[model samples]
Target: MQLPGDPRIDAIAEALLADPGDDRDLEAWAGELRISERTITRAFRSSTGLSFAHWRQALRIHRGLAMLAEGLEVHAVSDQLGYGHPSTFIAAFRRVMGTTPGAYADQP
Candidate 1:
């Protein structure tokens, strides 16, 4: 089904998916699409039913999962995902995924 929202939202989503590790700056993304941050935020919320920040957080968590699956340490994953520290990454991950990276990695 066709979604109703700014087309640029799709573009932004694609860019985020393509480079989940990239720093997520709303203003920069909006500028890239030649739109205002408010418009981007509105479109993102309307299209995905998530605020831009939440979507980015989800993307980061998914990326963190992939990095962990690839055998990267939590510290390395945090650095790669632009987190300031492994503990911060761990907190975010635990908040979203309800488990620590080390525990997740140990699962079969």
Candidate 2:
């Protein structure tokens, strides 16, 4: 994933990449980084070409792909990605990957 050049945004992205389950919302990150939430949101959009929420969701889905490739179960990947429910994760995975996790994982 391309990170925004802004150090604050880059840090948040790096942390999330390292642990896609990092669960820190924009407000939390902004509070910790001592910046206004608006700044972080703008930085994410301008540099990453996506809003903060979308970028983070993409990160989680990308991580889910790797987990699935490793043979993890759909529910497991969903939990690891911090989805409150497997169905929610499945919906998201379907949205990005065009199929259910089970179906995707079954692919050669």
Candidate 3:
């Protein structure tokens, strides 16, 4: 995956990788990086060929899979991944992986 070359985006990626459960949004990152949210949006899309929201969704789903494999409960994984609702997380996981977190986790 080709991440944006912008330092701000890089910082966000590092932060997300370090803590995938972070609830930080573009505004938070913009303030932290001392840039405008619009800049982050444009820069992110320009370099990654994906919107910030789209990228973050993929990141969260990817991390969620690992957490599930680690034996984390669905609700706990949803919360740890900054999901506001377990149902939302479950839906996203199902959409992306074609299986619910519980089913995936049950797979040996």
Candidate 4:
């Protein structure tokens, strides 16, 4: 998806794209940007067509695909993306990609 035009939203998007494993919540970002958390939440949904938390999960899972393709083990990718447990990462991956990380990596 293209970056949203709002400079503040764009800044958040760029940061996440650069570091998808950031794991920072919208409240933290809003605090850093000196905006109300509600403003950030509304702007994020309006600009991206996705709530901030959902977008961040999608972004992390998308990045996980690349890592898996590059031969990273599921546990390794999960750890690198800041998942506290491989099972959590696997569940999120399955939701986004319709397959477990190991299954995805085995695709020809």
Per-residue C-alpha lDDT of model 3 across residues 1-108, encoded as one tens digit per residue: 334677768988778877777888898898999999998898878878878888788889988887778888999989988899999999999988899888888888
Structural RMSD, model 4: 1.3
After TM-score superposition, the amount by which residue 39's alpha carbon in candidate 3 deviates from its true location, in angstroms, is 1.3
How many pairs of residues collide in each model? 0, 0, 0, 0
Q: Residue 13, candidate 1: how far off, in angstroms?
A: 2.0
Whole-model lDDT, candidate 2? 0.89
Compare candidates 3 and 4 on TM-score and give the better one. 4
lDDT by residue for model 1 (1-108), tens: 123346868776676677666775898887777889998888878877888888877888988898899999999999987788999899999999999989989999
Q: What TM-score fits each model?
A: 0.83, 0.93, 0.85, 0.90
Name the regions of candidate 3 deviating beyond 4 angstroms.
1-3
Q: After superposition, how far is residue 106 of candidate 4 from its true place, in Å?
A: 1.5
* Full candidate order by lDDT, most accurate first: 2, 4, 3, 1
TM-score of model 3 (CA atoms): 0.85
What residue pairs clash in candidate 1, if any at all?
Answer: none
Q: What lDDT score belongs to each candidate, Candidate 1 first?
A: 0.82, 0.89, 0.85, 0.85
Error of 3 at 10 (Å): 0.5
lDDT of 1 at 73: 93
Q: Who wins the TM-score comparison? A: 2
Q: Of the pair 1 and 2, which is ahead by TM-score?
A: 2
The alpha-carbon deviation from the true structure for residue 43 of candidate 4, after best TM-score superposition, in angstroms, is 1.4
Q: Per-residue lDDT of 14-51 in model 2, one digit per residue for the tens?
A: 88888888888888999899998999999888888889
